[model samples]
Target: MTETARDRLIVGLDLPTIADAEKIVSTLGNDVSFYKIGYQLVFAGGLEFARDLAKSGKNVFLDMKLLDIDNTVAKGVENIAKMGMSMLTLHAYPKAMKAAVEAAKGSDLCLLGVTVLTSMDEQDVIDAGYEYDPHTLVLRRAEQARAAGMGGIVCSAEESAAVRKIIGPDMALVTPGIRPAGADKGDQKRVMTPSEALKAGSSHLVVARPIVAAAEPLAAARAILAEMNGALAR
Candidate 1:
């Protein structure tokens, strides 16, 4: 099936308050259909907000990045599954990933295992006591996630091609750290343009500041979507 621009874009709602989120949604209007509600909004009573989005017929990517004991993560996945979210993210710990897979077995939710934060570099991985490079670690985690029956993986675009090679075409590769041309990288250590990410085999691109923080958010979103569509055309 041919991919639509909307299918390839997942905008992050990293705003602080529900009101701010509502404003962004209102501003972007129909230009955006999928949103990533991460830790900040989730902690600030965003599950109810998520329900609101679902009720309004918009897709939500709940980016809680849950990390806990097997049973705890399973319970969390169970609850998120019931919310009708399009996708949910969790740390790629073996036990947690397996438990989440089991919990989401009969649900429509797609569970994604987060490999590494785009903000972390090789030195940061080394500082964290890992002897391997970031790509090696990401590939290892991607394998583990696939083995555990995760629907996909959250990785930087720089590593998506290697991950696609390892996991094959069916596994969803959702790449974050997407920056448009001339945009700030923020704290993200690994980043790519929208076209670069798509060419690297990203099934979906998660973008935040490049769109949300722009002077004209809708225009910014359209620009990124155009780049994404151009890549798809190629």
Candidate 2:
């Protein structure tokens, strides 16, 4: 039950520029196996930088969280897959989620449906005009994503175990809002320590600030990896 690179960390490239992202990635080196390209990077460099990174033998987690009409999302997903991404993010809407999943089918890519953003809280859910509690809404949307044939979900580690119990083992759980033990919470509202996240059954952990902004990026990554190893040992 040792932790593998595929099962563990996904470093978030939340930098403002491609150069900054590359700087961080170069600093961290191979301590991290996967990197997440969120809206910021996609907006900054379009998809070419992503393609270059993927071609360089790094796993790219494209966290665009695509939410559009089924046809549009399907086409977008197809294009994204063509760029050789390992995973892509989509909202848990049935049509878009299904389209995304269908696009990833028979390809080496995985479509990850976002349940509720880790930056959001209960008030954020209410503000969005959702009547359900944030946790309940996350669970409900996760179920919807699964029913729509998505490969997995993007949720907080807090809800991961419950979702796993509902969705079973075949579906992967990619939990963002992960901080290493004793790290600052920053803007994320629903955060968990790395070990807690893995113990909650997260198939992958998305970490940003703590690793990217650390004084020693590689040491920080290794600290996170050590935590994951402890969880796997348990």
Candidate 3:
């Protein structure tokens, strides 16, 4: 099925509690369909909540950023796939991604290879013991993800266009760190407005604070969706 703008917009439920997540979900209503459950939510009974959302016909992106020995990674992927997750993220390590791809075979789960944290910049990459800068490293990992026969990539929108060229058209390019125009960027160092991210080849845009932190959460979400639709229409 062709994707609508709403379909491409993934709201990050980066809240601290499931109740808070529920409140946001209720507020967003039908205006939002996909959600990302990362560390903050995962520890607070978010796994079951993820299942509930999926059962209710919502797509859940489980942002675990998983990395481990091959067997452990494969085991986790197998269970997460059974949870009806639409997407799962693992650090872009070749061995782990290969194991995850193999384990997720025959499942609907799309394993996303996380290239680098959007909050990190050039100095951060060096601090992490990487010789290459953020942009170059993101592309290198994108290459490995493609070779692993993985489903997609998680990258900053800053690198989406280049990553898209490397991964080609079919793979999902899920971009996080999305900020609307004039919105406070918070801790995210790399961000793009919804339209800019979409035009740069981001297949899915994950937004958090811009929507959830707004006094009117629903309005913020709708506005972002409107911007996304406009970009897509153009």
Candidate 4:
């Protein structure tokens, strides 16, 4: 089967309003197949925007990173599955993760465990009272999700190589904290370029500012796609 572009990258809609998000969608169109709806835009446009995007043929990755009681999160997952979202993120709690996977069972939707926040560093985890190293934390979370029968995980591109090694070839690794070579890292600590991420076994790379904040958004998207294409060619 021909691979879909949506499998390659998930673009974060880091813009302020629905108008800005729609503008980016109009610019890239089918060049990008997956769009991430996180706290900001979901708060701005509500679930209707996500449903509209899915209706218009864009895969939605709902990045809520929900961490809550099993029943509440399971209901949320059920609602998202009914809405036809292809991917949803949940924090790595064994019961919650399993609940989410069970909620999505037999549906096309995928439940992804969030390993670690891209904005966090070693000190951040320590400050939060987690004694393990960030890498160890990510892997442990990934293993938890795997045992829960979830589809995959959300981790930084820096940890993609190690996560891939631990999870093996079949389990997907959707990595964020991806910056193109020479782009500003901004608040993110661990990051990788598109080519580097693909080479490191990331099933999909999530990029935000480098493309959205670019002076020319479409050009930026094309450039990242080119980088991904180059890596595939190699």
Per-candidate Cα RMSD to the true structure, in Å, reads 1.1, 1.5, 0.9, 1.4
Q: What is the C-alpha lDDT profile of model 4 across 1-234, one tens digit per residue?
A: 114434687899987799999999998887899889999988998478899999888889988999899999989998999998988999988999988988898798988999999999999999999989899999999889888998888999888888888877887789899998888999999999898988888888898888888999889988898888888778
Off by over 4 Å in 3: none
lDDT of each: 0.92, 0.86, 0.95, 0.87
Each candidate: how many clashes? 0, 0, 0, 0
Which prediction has more favorable TM-score, 1 or 4? 1
Among all windows of 10 consecutive residues in model 1, the one with the lowest summed lDDT is 1-10
For TM-score, candidate 2 versus 3, the one ahead is 3
Clashes by residue pair, model 2: none
Q: Is candidate 1 or candidate 3 better by TM-score?
A: 3
Clashing pairs in 4: none
Q: Model 1: which residue pairs collide?
A: none
Let me know the TM-score candidate 2 reaches against the reference structure: 0.96
For residue 234, model 3's alpha carbon misses the true position, in angstroms, by: 0.7
Give the alpha carbon lDDT tens digit for every residue of 53-122 in model 3: 9999999999999999999999999999999999999999999999999999999999999999999999
Q: What is the lDDT of residue 64 in candidate 2?
A: 89
Error of 4 at 61 (Å): 0.4
Residue pairs whose backbone atoms clash in candidate 3: none
| By TM-score: ranked, best first | 3, 1, 4, 2
Give each model a TM-score: 0.97, 0.96, 0.98, 0.96
Candidate 3 deviation (Cα RMSD): 0.9
- Score residue 35 of candidate 2 by CA lDDT: 91
